[model samples]
Target chain A: MTSASKSLTAETLIVQEVAPRDGLQIEPVFVPTEAKIALVDALSAAGFTRIEVSSFVSPKAVPALRDAAEVFAGIARRPGTVYVALVPNLKGAERALAAGADEINLVMSASETHNRANMGMSCEASLEAFGHMVAAARGTRATINATIATAFGCPFEGPQAVEKVEALVARYGDLGVDGVTLADTTGMANPRQVADLVRRTLARVPAERLTLHVHNTRGAGIANVLAAHGAGARRFDAALGGLGGCPFAPGATGNVCTEDLVSLCHEMGLETGLDLAALIGLARGLPALVGHEVPGQVAKAGRPCDLHPAPARKAA
Target chain B: MTSASKSLTAETLIVQEVAPRDGLQIEPVFVPTEAKIALVDALSAAGFTRIEVSSFVSPKAVPALRDAAEVFAGIARRPGTVYVALVPNLKGAERALAAGADEINLVMSASETHNRANMGMSCEASLEAFGHMVAAARGTRATINATIATAFGCPFEGPQAVEKVEALVARYGDLGVDGVTLADTTGMANPRQVADLVRRTLARVPAERLTLHVHNTRGAGIANVLAAHGAGARRFDAALGGLGGCPFAPGATGNVCTEDLVSLCHEMGLETGLDLAALIGLARGLPALVGHEVPGQVAKAGRPCDLHPAPARKAA
Candidate 1:
């Protein structure tokens, strides 16, 4: 085996479950606040080190997560599990901080067109707004992080330049954010691009502070994750049952499934510290929660080690 | 970027379209002979250098592919494209050669339980049988290759040993087959394992003569492909629209989607020589052909470069 593949087996990957935030944000139906809290509690019990519990966005803009504060208040936060809440602006940051969120995640798109359409501001304005939010949370316990959406490609703007994302990371660093996530908002990332970008970004940011958030829209999410991991990325974001989609990209699918990602990690001998069966159990319950079958494969098809009984005779 | 990912962009991958054979074999409804022929023809037109047209097995065993002979005879042969037919034994090999197939693919499982359950023979017996078939095709114009199913893992037997798969490759080498394919029948392959296996297998077989066939059952199909590609396996097997499932492993998805694989390769700057647009067009037509929605992502989401128009105003 090559040195790279050998090292992969020894590494530990930190999974940040984004189902409650990214996944539920786009769901057509609003889950009960209690159920949302239960989902986060289940994820925390499943051994996730970090969980994005909810978004502090406007209730009118995203009624699906309208009960975010209630859900956040109700969840039984584990001692080691960092509860994260996504905040759109200074107001959202204040609300999340007041709710005692362990971490506050801010988001802005890398592409100008996506920034305008998603955040109602240009890239410059969004970064400027983020500076005020960072300054506002200066003495708070919440570790501030920013996600650059459409970091790989945008539905409206197409493939993004790597330098544009690098510049955003630098800007986030200047604003004193704790970490940064490169979100493939529309699932436009390829493995090679992921490796190249991760390598370049890691040069600017520490491996522990960088995370990869990808969608499986075109079936390259897992591949991109592996590529980034191979390129020295340690943290990743995944959602339960792959329950998320891009509002702008009409047919785009959800984020990379958490159970599937965990299964792959365990199979590769990488330490995830997450229970596969527990994640699968949570994934299987997602269909009822979302009122539809999910895109996650591990939930439908059991793990590789979960052997099936031998047929009575030749069946295949 | 790492040197491994840099060389990835310079590689030209060989994709063998397996939808006409593997994809159709598990379908409940039979596709018309003309439609099967048209599918192969379309795949050839789409720049697939190799296409597994049909399987020369018992009609009662796989009624969906019962028109194997007719479909093989009707396809408009492209000069540079190789028409491959899957054969089980000498009789099937004779039929494939008689039907004017350019290549013949033989399959046997790596594990004893899978071999007994899939082919009704021991691994020893299957290898002995393949020897006879290989001898029979010694002087024929058709090139002979063997696929070791359950190469990475088995539903009945669980994870396979790399040494066991290596022994199979060595034995196939002794049989003097032109090529060999490592088939992840149930998509149990992880990227690290794929890399390790490919690196070992390539030591026994040349890069051009080795193919990796993986399913997306666990959502790691594309990741395994990239891992093998990075490890020096040049050829891969994928199905149109990700149609097909293992009869033994319930809920196992089809082979990796062809269009998505092609899209990933192109985006990574790897040469696939196939047209992504044409593959997507064929993938989009699969649901109507199969009477259900397929698992392919690119067909539903379009290619990464297939940009969508910007929203009129702030939509996200």
Candidate 2:
């Protein structure tokens, strides 16, 4: 009935869970290793096809996820659940590979200034390093995926040029990565920008190989996801309890919430193969785990299908 | 570049400010009458074409806005700006017209159970009352608008039949409302549902007379707005600082934020005719007035075009 509904063809949408890695990385207190494993296992059991378990960065860099190795080793590997890990360089890639990561996700900023501030290197240098890292894991069991951080806009640089993002996708495709994720590092993406980038990126990479990662920092995260989905891009990265933020990006908050996205997709008649009730249960545990309230909403406001009893007394 | 983007052609989107009424109606403490007048004045100077100043309901019914008449009398009304007031019955409508309201907004719930619970009357009773209220305001200089609350879904009734909403809208048209607003009272709305309802409603109403009012309860407020905008809904109702929630709806939160929506529209290349910087400044003052934090994002995150300085030291 609408252009957006008409543009969407695929019935099933892929939701890649990134709570453990992206969500907890910015926390002041480190989550217990067992809790990390438990969170990933719960997400896996809740029907997530892919889960970013942790990152293989230096403990000094992100002390919260320092127990990445223990977390990976402790999780009960579900056969269908592909475990993913973020890698900064060849050393991190090797660590992740040794920890049995099914997919190694590499990230670089689309904005040169953000790249310099975040990775302590130039965009050219980061791509060169990624090329070597991809070659190193070419014959391994791990599939590689490159993420263009700040693909929508940068905290240090305004809106990124669509041509630069498309070129980055092309470069990653040429580098022989299994997939690519366009990351809105600070929730700076709008739905229109997302649709434009997703449409152009799809020309360079197949739908199955592209992921849209967004944040609800400016309240357009889910809208951006809807735009990408309408443009035929399916896979999405969301954090459980809407936890996650870039420490380097001022005013950055939660990523597009997992349960909320699943709820919206399910309501729109899109299959996410997820248990919304179970996801809500896990989200309800986030505040206690992080010692603060999380930004997720569906956990607080039940699904639309969840009916309430009539009020006992008349409301004024 | 994309279907959704192509669907948006009107360069300027109308933002109807509902903060003075919807936002403060649910507040625990009453804002001073002078403060309310100042807010209305500030919002008028900020270029809002329409502002819901207050409601003419009984003081016992909505004590927060008890000084509605005083507030209306104290403000300096601007030219080209419509000052609206919510009227529950013929008496309320008369009161609003006597107080010199530019537009009288009448509201009824689409869901029968919600209507009964919220208004302490059936949908038929509310409609009958609105008929009289509309008739009362017809000969006056004030324009009349009818709002269908819980148009998306009702917490007590669940998903409302689109046919039922259409019937209500058609009935409102027959009663001769100058315009109509479809409100997602508790934010139980998704992008697809919004697109469908908006497209169907637009078939019965012209683009200029239809307004989409959504809340950020489940984090789909902005997305729903985007969907409606794509479906040819040019007018929208937003609360400053994302303030406002239905007291009858158990888990209700803030309405779609004014500053966040404007920031998004500007970023998406849509004109709102409102000042983003001025709106953000007003939003920043919400905490002091309400004695708590608000749910707004852009007030904290800044606009996407807002850039940050490079970190002095490299971020790890």
Candidate 3:
């Protein structure tokens, strides 16, 4: 934890690669366990300090990620990279710990309607369950990260209240969770909203203990990230090929593309400490796995500095 | 001009819809003249104060927009909405003026390499030609706009010098053009670059006389627009359904989507004065016109306020 904290300087932003977990989880075709392990291992070499490997949810609920245990077990962990797993309950947390997850990420929607639809639980019940899981994980080496889904907005319930989100984050703080992720599950976030909410959240939570998970459903993902960064957030969750969609958020698109975000940060002179080319290669390779072109732009357009030769003129 | 200028208050931004012109110029298939007129008429009804109708270039050079004459002649002109046409040379300007275009938009690449590749002439030659066009349009009731293409970067000649762009804008000002458009022709612009360039350009050009034309080749289009807006640029050129691309820049994607940009402005409480739902409907109609799905996101994902019903729960 000391080394991880030290690695993130004032100029450095932490990009937690979540393609294996968040991206693949929403994919219809179940990616082979070996392929998932390969992706995680490749991402580990791409200078990412953290990578979310898989989710330990009910097999019936998300069959695409049913091989989470196999993927976690098969991947060769890098020395400094923190590999995380999404845990829906105590059972999932227990399975994740057993499979050697460095951290367990818990998710619950901020809106009661969304919470009921997504997890079949009330917000209070979800918080109580996470509290129990926090206690249960205290004995293990794994840390806990409570992600409040639809923290920005909900499909079933338009805009979410900032107070509701703040209370949830406060509860996660009280439960001694390692961090909290404010996810724009359906991409309903705007720059002004992001700046305001992130500024308020930083008042209660440390910047290092916060991560912004923005979706591009409305094509405002990168702008929202910039606003959150301006408001003192240092960590963001992105997928390799901009893959990931909330099953609950109608018309929701993928998470912000890792390559696109990296390109933006690099262009702005913000240090991301990640190999952009390696991430682009990974993103380009994803269409083969997903059976279609992904949403990432940098992979196709090349970096801003990638120049082309002058075309040969024909005789006029 | 006074009422139009008055409508654009400090809190208001002008959106110049360019789907009929710049958006379809690089498209492989030629949209019928009637469809182009229909789109222009619908956009005029949607509260767009300005619309780029078509480019009067050589039919041999750009067959996709060869019906420019018919498009400009067929559309019923709206009183408040200014109908503009792209004029590459004195011939194009004459054709535009004859067709009753309100404004003639002259284009020339800032980079010598791109100028030669795109317009088959040196930058000096293109500017000289535009100078003649500007002089020719002086007595015609048609205003002139000098659009400096590849103002941010060139595919053949990397990043453009701000000094060179400023010099061009200063030249356009000397030539007595009505406006100047700094085009990021290849989508190679970042927000910081946009802010710096727009701020410097605004020092030499009036806010009303300047337009920021950005492409989304690298996914920074909307962010760049926001930066330019922050730096005192009030007018922007956007394409319906993100339909435009630079033929000279390899792998360059579409111009910023008009509906998506409108959504962003509306969400931020900045007044666009455009009917968003009507614009979205026109955007949704673009696929049939172009024979492929367009790139705008607002049509696919809908607006943020568009809510969905909660899923009916089954007995657990």
Q: Write the per-residue lDDT of candidate 1 for residues A1-316, one digit (tens) a residue.
A: 0011222232878888999999999889889988898999999899887899999999998999888788878999787778989999889999998889888899999999988988988889999899988987889877888999999999999888889899999999889898899999989999888989999999988787888999999999898888899899988999989889866445556899889999998898889889889999999999899898788988888888889998876743
The alpha-carbon lDDT assigned to residue B218 of candidate 2 equals 85
Question: What lDDT is obtained when candidate 1 is compared to the true structure?
Answer: 0.87
* Deviating ranges (above 4 Å) for candidate 1: A1-10, A248-251, B1-10, B248-251
Cα lDDT of model 2 by residue, B228-287, tens digit: 888889889999998997554444458899998999999888998788999999999988
Rank the candidate models, highest DockQ first. 3, 1, 2
Best by TM-score: 3
On residues A157-242, what C-alpha lDDT tens digit does candidate 3 reach at each position? 99999998999888888989999999998888888899999998999888888899998877788888887887889899999878
Error of 1 at B286 (Å): 0.5
Better of 1 and 3 by lDDT: 1
What tier of docking accuracy does candidate 3 attain? medium
Clashing pairs in 3: none
Worst 10 residues of 1 chain B by lDDT: B1-10
| Reference-based TM-score of each model | 0.96, 0.95, 0.97
TM-score of chain A of 3: 0.96
Question: Which tens-of-lDDT digit does each residue in A1-316 have in candidate 2?
Answer: 1011222348768889999999999999888998998999999899988899999998998999999989999999887778999999889999999999988999999999989888988999999999989987888888898999999988887888998988888888778898899999888988888888888888888788888998988888898898899998988999998898655444445899999899989988899889999999999999999988887888888888888887763653
* Clashes by residue pair, model 2: none
Listed models, DockQ each? 0.56, 0.55, 0.56
